[model samples]
Target: MNLKPLKGQHHVSAITANAQKNYEFYTNTLGMRLVKKTVNQDDTSMYHLFYADERGNPGTDLTFFEIPNAGRTYRGTDSITCTFLRVPTDDSLLYWKKRLEDHGVSHEDIRKGGTRMVLFFEDFEGQLLALISDQGNGGVKGGSPWARSPVPQEHGIIGLGPVMLTVSDLGPTEEMLTEVMGFRKKGPYRLEVNGENTVHVYETGEGGNGAEIHIIERPDLAQQRPGRGSVHHVAFRVEDEEELRRWIQKLKEQRIASSGFVERYYFKSLYFREPNGILFELATDGPGFEGDEPFEHLGEKLALPPYFEGQREQIEARIKPLNTKSP
Candidate 1:
């Protein structure tokens, strides 16, 4: 069946033990805009905070689900190990290194990752993250940084870059990504990771930093024990609900057991796990964060979807109050 390939990286969702600290790091320290403050649809007892570029664009979002007191993540195979953010130029990497130092954020000296320069770092909860310099890179374009971001526009993060996935076996995962999901192999790069030396690169739709997935084969390690700072899933972009429905149909044909169609209010989604058991989601790009709240006051208040509006008071009472208002 002929189908349109996924556009690129939509967003990366991870778990956080504390919403306040998560907000502080992604917004104040990293300088991303807090675009949405809502609860996890399935579990309204916790907060699902979204941070992105100026408009909460599809390729820019980095979200967290607050699971109060969640245990620490023990790194292993079969995990979405590291999430990369994009900086405009090679010089921006230097800017971020000093910025990370000033903020007391643990980071490594700039090093080369494939064709680009990357600076590795950890969040407050030890979420493995890196800033990749998009110097001379092209493909799916990055988003506009928030105008009021503390980090200067030239040095601020523009959008998400490549996501690192570590799995026990690479064959099934690679086949699922290529033949099933339409990702094209962009060749492999050598990186010594957990004793699993080579990392293969895959790219979909207008491939580039924003649309690549780097997979590492590490049969030696066990599955990760996920908790705080663990990535829950990574989503790829679909143009609209129509496109998302097509993707759902495609998954059904492949006999992949998926969540089918999930209405997220802001976007429609279809979730399924690949061979390695890593959750993957295909989500629509629109009916975005602005539907309930205006741009200027995006995440200031607890904005619930219409269906969840009735239980607003109860949801509010259960989840701790988080002040997401911009400074």
Candidate 2:
């Protein structure tokens, strides 16, 4: 059967408190580019900021809705967990270690993840995040924001490497990831090559979503409360709107609860919750980050989707300024 899996890890969007700080931490500190600065279709009071590679490609993008008035989210056993990006492993993270230090960014020293080096940290919103790699996935070039990671442009962030998630029920979510999403199961979870520390692992395509979307199965953990550190939602990609619509119907037929298609400007999104309670979104691939501004000055302007075409001024006025600030 021709699998209709996602194109790759398109992007992950989360809710944040300060759009500027979020932009700064992602770009200035992490070396990701602020590819897009748009307004949320549902609530214009917030800004939808996108961070991605050089060209603002699909699978390499990460987005956020800066909700200033929003409260803090909790991060722990019941949370959606951290998102990990892959960078060249040969001394690349060494630069990152000091980069975090020079910027005064708080982070734990390098940690071990199977055969990879996993450095975990948190954003201003307290959202758990990490950078992990076993030498990056070949040639995926990324826009490096810092001057330190001078290992050359051939190796930058090769898109999301892995995403760790905790859940009460892994059955339905597993079906969606492998069957519906088309990821190949690597095998039973393995954290050690010799079978010391084992953990679930799955793979698909190349480096785009590279070995990502990890689910931590712990039914005994209590439910999480949403505040400052929880992940809002994770988005998988479909080639186009037609593919998206097709899945919308397929999801319904599969008996998996789903949401109506939402036109999110750059791309349309369909939201739903896995049985374990983590929100999952299937978003389209097109209208990439360049839809609003040129790659050179992508985040400089106040970009708004067609939904907010006429209300741009009012919406812009309502939203407070942050690093992703605009006119």
Candidate 3:
């Protein structure tokens, strides 16, 4: 029997000190829409903002939470960090380089990949992140508002291709990704980022698309200190809650130790720390994001889960508004 397809990545959450700067980068510079603007139910002092293509497509999202006074956390072998956005192949890079340059936002020169081209940049908190040239392979739909690069609505990042981590041991982590998560190894390899060791990498394939998970093997690096402005976790998709149970069984059978499942509104999640200290989540696919809000206005306004709705006034008042002047 064929293994069921993972729901694919839903979205990645990043911490941002200057939610405003993060806002401009995702919206104005990167050409995405601010789908949701709500408060973190856990700590409503800041805003949890979401950005994505029209309709707030799942794979196309790059969301952030605004935390102005958070300290810069250290990243090392134990951290699974950064989110990459994919654009059409035609001329997205030219558009981005000029856009960032025009806004005086710092960005690197175009980075060429075997099949994709990437440009890495830091968010306000120095969080490592990038925008990739997906070359229209993913069902990228809708043209971006950024005029520099025009892509017919069909090549944006369809889903997360890969996420990079620096782990102390590759064994358990590899087991989590391949055996537990269903990613097939395309074999170990090196990625020629600028012809230099931009990173130490291992490649895995899902369906036909490939994702390279990088691990920096230096012993000097320490484990991650998670906090605002740092990545809290990375999530992978399962078809439904039933598949979720199977994943739980697989983890137990393998003695991988999980933190148990947690309800995340619209999706159920189970978290476990791989051997390297990277937080990985197994999330369900059904009751898709659309289950919460109508597709047409997924992120139009502050739509809270029914559970959180009772605290709207308190939540709204607690979060400081977007700083219009970040970055």
What TM-score against the true fold does each predicted structure earn?
Answer: 0.98, 0.86, 0.81
Tens digit of lDDT per residue, candidate 3, span 1-327?
234645455567777778777777665555566666766656766788877666554445566777788777777667766566666553767776776677677678886644467777766566777666767443323224222212334443333545667666667777766676666554344554323434544443243222445554545666777656687777766667877777777777778889676776766878887776667777775465576677655555676778888888887777665643211
**Tens digit per residue, CA lDDT, model 2, 98-154:** 777887876777867755777776777667777775563442233343223222444
Q: Candidate 1: where is the Cα deviation over 4 Å?
A: 193-196
Using lDDT as the yardstick, the better of models 1 and 3 is 1
How many backbone clashes does every candidate have? 0, 11, 9
Compared with the true structure, model 2 gives a TM-score of 0.86
lDDT top scorer:
1
Query: Which is the leading candidate under TM-score?
Result: 1
For candidate 1, what's the RMSD? Answer: 1.0
lDDT by residue (209-236, candidate 1, tens digit) is: 9999999898989899999999999999
The reply for model 2, stretches above 4 Å from the true place, is 1-3, 134-156, 188-198, 206-211, 323-327
Worst 10 residues of 1 by lDDT: 188-197
Runs with alpha carbons beyond 4 Å of true place in candidate 3: 1-7, 136-159, 187-212, 226-228, 323-327
